[model samples]
Target: MRTTDLQLASALGAWRRPGVALARALADAVGGAALDGRLRVGSPLPAERRAAAALGVSRGTLTAALDILRVEGWVDTRHGSGSTLRLPPEAAMRLAPVSAVGEDGAIDLRSAVPAAPHTAYQQALLRAAERSGPVLAESGETGPGLPALRSLIAGRYTEEGLVTRPEQILITSGARAALALLTAHLRPRAAAVEIPAYPAVLAGFRASGTRLAGFRVAADGWDLDQLHDAFRAAAGGVAYLVPDFQNPTGALMPDAARRTVARLAERYRVTVMADETMRDLDLRPAPSPLERIPRAVLVGSAAKTVWGGLRVGWIRGTAALVGELACHPLCEPLSAAPTQQLVAAELLRDPARVLDHRRTALRRQRDHLSGLLAGDSRWRFTVPPGGLALWLRLTDVRSDVVAAQSSAYGLELSPGQSFAADATCAHHLRLPYTSPITTLDRVAAVLDAACGGQGQGPRVPGPGR
Candidate 1:
């Protein structure tokens, strides 16, 4: 076929489907094959004018399609070089899941989700509904969250000696949203993240279009020196730290490191955003670094401790900064769902009643999974003393490929690369032990099939075990 005909044929396939937008369809079509491969090494793509004429799309629409491909890292365009595929089209698709996994169904260990159905949660919901009269019309002292919930969150900090005020609290849609708001305001020239951090956080940063640097968090501890170096390199960019039961690695920042980070931030005049989303949910209560180190932004969410659908999180900082964050542009939907805030408020009001069932269930799940994965030869992990997940480092295989293949066996896995600042995780996976025993056993069986029998793994049971 003539080159012109090939271009026309490709464009035809892209826009032939009805209902689906032409640009998106074009992306889905060329995204998996030709355009993806040709963009990698300064290879020339068909001239825009030629492609547009052949495909019968407006030049503007063709430009939009190329722009979409650029954002997704499929094609690199130059003034003279046209476009070059950065990686194989297949590699681009590798980033997307083959199928969607649901909450009520599937053995999904891809996220460190809190197990559901605790009596405490139902009781909290019931109490909130009883007091729902005031919140029906969205009338409240605090805009996004109920005053009581803010007070409760503030009180927790007060116990740690950080004099906090309810007015300084800005409840957000979720932990991810809270971070995005902060990133919007603190649009620094550059930013830093821990290598193998949370994937969602990584996604947020990408969406925000911020320059990023990455530092390693070691098994022994966070590389404090690397953190200091990163800050120094960025001058005064914001640094995101998950100090308590960190998402993917489950490495709790030590007290000394916390103090050291605070000191460095003060010296360098940089702001630290401490993520405490997984704090109180640990099996053993560990002291939070935010309470000890006052030089940072403290972010918390009920999702990890309670349920993912709660849609409530708070950013705690100096009263002045917190006030600014509350009125930030992102609060447009009027500060989270009112009913959800009301529910969180009721749950905070009676902690013991709301947390009793969750604590028991989490402990049981964590213990059972740890026991099952223990003695397995292919995986190794430092089973977290108190959280919903275990961070396992693969012995020899590449975890990214392994996770990609897991879906075929009815297992959903989170490859460590998803959390890295650079797309490079090949030896790690975050396994949330939130599955029931039977489900966990099934996961173990899959692991066995995937990685040869009784893989040499550590089954750690501390405190709860």
Candidate 2:
């Protein structure tokens, strides 16, 4: 993919800074873009002259910046052809922070995934092994998903007041895959998504070349007027929503907002894709939005509730839509591993015990982390009713700089801009409470030092600062 000068400039938001070398800042911006998957590997960059013009920088400065990128192996420059982006080994690991362990046993707070229920998981695995014979005896080809697992998931939705059928479910490897498949099948020209949403969602839509129309999800909750405008503008497109315990911010869309979204979606002829991955982590009771937006295609996953290792997720839509997705070329005929499906099904059969255990732990951790953050006046946040992370607004610090400096303190932080559709939310940061209370206490200390300028480390100034 060839990145346009305009796009590159947009990605290099606020590269110019006081007391910072322009060339180095430009290089850092490029590296940041590469690390964030914005400037993808092998992406051809615009010519140096054009890029410099776009950035309002001189050609000499651009050349020096390119030299830095080349030295850092973040870009490969050729005499005839232009420079192309490269993903350094360390940057590659940073991109997959969820699975990557930090050096010197650093604390990793980049991912919001929860810890698995060990005893319940062990029991589920044993039960799956015991029940494997019947599944193995069959051809082992499930078109949409394992029927038993689909039935279990559909039954759970039904119990939640949403009438669902097994036929309406198409299981996938995980929620991410489910969403990718939906986007591929829908192939909408534009998509309406919540600003400061899940990073993976934004990256996925951008990768698919879909124009995004973002609606800000404030700290309180969704603004129905803004949501209605976004829907009306993106009419005949698609809207991806995470109304139940929205990621990052953790704001739960009220029942009234859900109904308004349903009505607007219908009025504007928009296809609504509701992500319910965080629904099970509810610290407060809220009605399922699916009941209000019956036409919306819902996505669910066991990764959040039961275990991240399960990798079992499903899409719930009209039976016809399910059939279409099942037959879609992009859709893999076979679902996740049979063993995983069996384990997920076993866990789902009686999930209350396991879910309750997880919810209890998460609630305690959330409160503990919130209490810790409340001590500092510089940090202001609303304690979300549910969700794995807290979206914090830093009063006098830039989240990007703080996150960049946190590495020196052995803390891996996810800056807020990663979750934005554009280069906004620079003052925000997301800290997950998934870690143990002791670890969160340590995290708070590291965050305080990092934000308070107590550490001696190379700090990248915020854009235009």
Q: Write the per-residue lDDT of candidate 2 for residues 1-465, one digit (tens) a residue.
A: 799999999877766533458997688778766755557679899988899999999999999999999987898888898899996543432212233223235777788876566667787889899989988997766679888999999898888888899999998988998999999988988888998888888899999999888888966998777787789778998999998889989998877788888888889889999999988788764534434455789988988887677888889999999999999876774367777889999888998877776776678668767876675678789999887889999898899999988777778789999998976899999998876543455577678778874433224322212
Looking at candidate 1, what is the lDDT of residue 50?
80
Report the C-alpha lDDT of model 1 over 1-465, residue by residue, as the tens digit: 123435445533423333456786566455544432322233456778888777788888788888888876667777866775455322321211112213234456676675333455676689889988877765543554667778888887887678788877788878887888888888877777888788778777777787778888844568877888877765687888888777777777778888888887787777888898877765664433344556688888888766777788888888788777767766645366777888888766666533554565567657767776776558788767566678888898888767766666667788887888888667988777665443455566566555644454223112111
Question: Global lDDT of each model?
Answer: 0.68, 0.80
Output the worst ten-in-a-row residue range by lDDT, candidate 2: 92-101
* Clashes per candidate (backbone, < 3 Å): 14, 1
User: Lowest summed-lDDT stretch of 10 residues in model 1?
Assistant: 92-101
